[model samples]
Target: MRELRILRPIAKLEDAAVLDPVVREVHRVVDAVLKPRALEDLLHGVPAGHPMHPALVLVPAGSWIGAAVLDVVPGASRASRTLIGVGVLAAAPAIAAGWADWARSRRQQQRVGVVHAAANESAWVLYTASWLARRAGHDGFGKVLALAGFGLVGFGGYLGGHLGYRQAVGANHADAVVQRFPTGWHELGVLDDLPEEAPVRIEVAGEPLFVLRRGSRVDVLADVSTHLGEPLSDGRIDDPGHRGATITSSLGSVFEVATGEVVHGPATAPAVRFETRINGELIEVRLPRS
Candidate 1:
């Protein structure tokens, strides 16, 4: 419910005339600088499909939790503190990965993400202060700092949940197999009207399809990219290789397409393949529907 409420304030702020300039500047910063590279890498997955952020979170969380437990134990040693330090250090890369992912989102999403990042950053600062205080023999101050850091981490985690479940950032919409075409083939349209070396938008049974004409054959795919709902037809075709073609979106995200294989990140699945007849010849291609 809080997540749902957060969107209300974001929407209301959008309507205020005074906020336009500030919002525009923020948009420019994100779009012009942060997006082109950081976002692309985040979505592309530096560690395969596994995002770096979630992987990194284990470090800090595990470290702090271990430290807290050590504090309560009867025979806790300096080694425990050292372990905590190691965990905190390990968490840094994950945080960087998550931030890179967040930087590329829409302004509204970025606004929420910024707060989320701030909360986590503050937690890290507090944790670091706690570590220093403990090492300096200020046990009380160290415990207090650790508690404060824990509280901040909790708040940050809450915001993260909202971003993921409510805003749907870094989520794959196509993961759910909502509907599937029948095993048998379905007709799209007359092949003659489709242009050569151009992506043509078409509909089959009310499903949007991106049809690419290559010589007499065609390559069809769902018009919408699985990642961020970007339009596939808007993407350009790249060189033919093991990566058959690269579809570049307006957002600067590139999707690789193989001859018979599903393209790389963003889109998790292969485009639906369709076999149809053109000029009395059987042609195989991929197209989108529903």
Candidate 2:
């Protein structure tokens, strides 16, 4: 089946050269400003186990939408203005969370994301203006501005939905590995060839894997980052011991080497881990039983 007509141009935005300059600058700025590991993890929702932007967005979205409803009702001017003010205030953190998530996404997703952010920022500006106008007793003008802002919000929301559902921007990339991989033990390679305390890339069972050996124990995980599919083998291995070892992806996601638990974000999903054993000189791996 063919894709929707509107999606053709939107999809083309992935390769749009016009956005490269802006995307680069925004990326630099965001990375510089959100340099603190703790802050970035919080924004990416590491503690929450998923992206936080979507949930944070509901506050401002609901407030602005509720304001729109109140605007049309008689004797509701004060309530509508209050709601608009509330939306303006609530939009700050939501925008921050969205930016944090966007900063770490792939170029294609970032292309759409930049436009999404622009639209939302424009809407926010309008809402802020509307609130100020209402405070200044310009009720009719405030209503007009609020309506325009709401329109931009709808457009921005559509782009956000496209980024998530269609483009798989914030989805867990490694969630399906176990489902498709064959069950039971599969031979990986000779145990002696597997370097000690170092990550190695191996292709087996139709998937790329990150293999790390420490003495008798071996830790295996899908080689793809759960955030954006950056090669986990290219990432830095920290505390390369059997216990408390972690791998930090190039894009700044940290995962526990043994259990595949996400230690940081922009990655909320754990890597696909494998159970390992040694058959003499040979190494074997299988998906761990749930």
lDDT of 2 by residue, 1-290 (tens): 98789767876777888998999999999999899989999988989988999999999999999999999999899999999989899999999899999998888889999999999999999999999999999999999999999999998998999999988887888877777888899999998888889889999989899999998788999999888888899999998975989999998889999899998899988889998888988999998883
Residues 1-290 of candidate 1 have per-residue lDDT tens digits of 36476456644432355644555565566446544554546544633654556657877788877877787777674755675577668767766666666655556666676667778889888888877887998877877888888888887887787777777776654433226443435566666766766777877655676667766667666666555666767777777332266676554445554332334443333443444446454443333343
Which runs of model 2 end up more than 4 angstroms from their true locations? 1-7
Which pairs clash inside model 2? Answer: none
**Model 2, 178: alpha-carbon shift in Å?**
2.1
Tell me the RMSD of model 1 versus the true structure.
4.7
Clashing pairs in 1: 220-286
Name the lDDT of candidate 1: 0.62
lDDT of 2: 0.91
Alpha-carbon local distance difference test for all models: 0.62, 0.91
Local error of candidate 1 at residue 69 (angstroms): 2.9
